[model samples]
Target: MAQVILTFFVAYGIVVGGALCGGIGAFLTHKPPLLSMELLADQLKIFGIVGALGGSFDSFLQIEKILIGNFSPVVKQLAMIVVAFLGAHIGTICVQWLVQVRS
Candidate 1:
């Protein structure tokens, strides 16, 4: 139980840190959404409330694995999940930069 709690804490920290960095970087980049160029263009509709803000983007990749019928080990799956999240956050920040921000 302690180990499980510790793991959860660690994971939480990483995710939170990543999100903060990503969000701030994204703000600095001021890039618009790939799907929408205007403010409040609404990009979350694509996820249909399933993947709301703060949710890890890794989820999509896990779904992809299920669709692809590719069986990865538990550890590998976890790694992929982490990778997905990191990539998404980083990519989001980059996108923001590309669009250019006013503030």
Candidate 2:
């Protein structure tokens, strides 16, 4: 339970932080900050997931366990991954709303 929540927050933070930093970089380079943020948010989703999961080794392990007829850990891992993805997505939406770049 705690681990799941932590994973979600970690993923969320990664997206939000990455987007904000990217926006700053764009601003420094005389580009559009909001557009850069939106683009970075999209690009950072997979990174957020992988980061929250602490890299891909555990996920691969879960897959192996699933193939070996043990489903509980794999199911929990899947749930965590889903929650992490939701967190990253929501963070992107938040950036979009902040920038008012999307309808």
Candidate 3:
């Protein structure tokens, strides 16, 4: 539990700190950096919180375990879909611009 929380914070720091460094570099070189560091900081906080919640959800799930594959299929399916959507959305939103820039 504590380990997961610590990892989330550390990961968030790596993300925001790297973005800040890149933003500062761009500012020094007179480039726009695409997005402001402040905006990125706000986004990182949101992203980290959501990520932690999603990752820790299973641990906190308060459902009784069933025998012979008798879990709540609807909830399981919904969770899977939600997680997939989140993964795709994050990948697309985060990397779309970078991909375009490289082309």
Candidate 4:
């Protein structure tokens, strides 16, 4: 359906955009954006795209879980968006550091 496709596109965009921001931040800080391609490949092989996407949207998922009954819909959505960006940014930094240290 159109809705499902649109949703996937939006999620992908958010995740990738966050990653790009993180990479840029690292570059600005003079840190190399090192990534372990082999490990990433292995994770992809095991988890598949759907699983990876779910992982990337963890902030959204968690926020949805915790805020579903207590907060206004708009508030929950906005909070998730903020958390997702921050989570991805932090995740990228940690991953790059891990790869750089391992290699």
Ordering by TM-score: 2, 3, 4, 1
Quality of model 4 by C-alpha lDDT: 0.45
User: Which ten contiguous residues of candidate 1 have the minimum total lDDT?
Assistant: 39-48
Better-scoring candidate (lDDT), 1 or 2? 2
Q: Across residues 1-103, which tens digit of lDDT does each residue of candidate 2 receive?
A: 9998999999999999999999999999999999999989989999998999999687768877877899999898889889989988898888888888854
- For every model shown, the clashing-pair count is 2, 0, 0, 0
Q: Quick one: best lDDT, which candidate?
A: 2
Model 2 local distance difference test score = 0.90
Candidate 2 residue spans exceeding 4 A from truth:
none
- Per-residue lDDT, model 4, residue 62, is 51
Quantify all predictions' global Cα lDDT against the true fold: 0.41, 0.90, 0.49, 0.45
Please rank every candidate by lDDT, starting with the best. 2, 3, 4, 1
**TM-score of candidate 3 to 2 decimals:** 0.36
For model 4, how many clashes?
0
Where is model 2 poorest over a 10-residue stretch in terms of lDDT?
Answer: 94-103
Give RMSD to native, each candidate.
Answer: 11.6, 1.4, 9.2, 10.8
- Candidate number with the higher lDDT (3 or 4): 3
| lDDT score of residue 84 within candidate 1 | 40
Better model by lDDT: candidate 2 vs candidate 3: 2
- For candidate 1, write residues 16-77 as lDDT tens digits: 34444445655668853332322221231222122322354554455567556675644454
lDDT of 4 by residue, 4-103 (tens): 3444444444444444555566667886544432234233332233433355465355557545565565464554454444444444444445456464
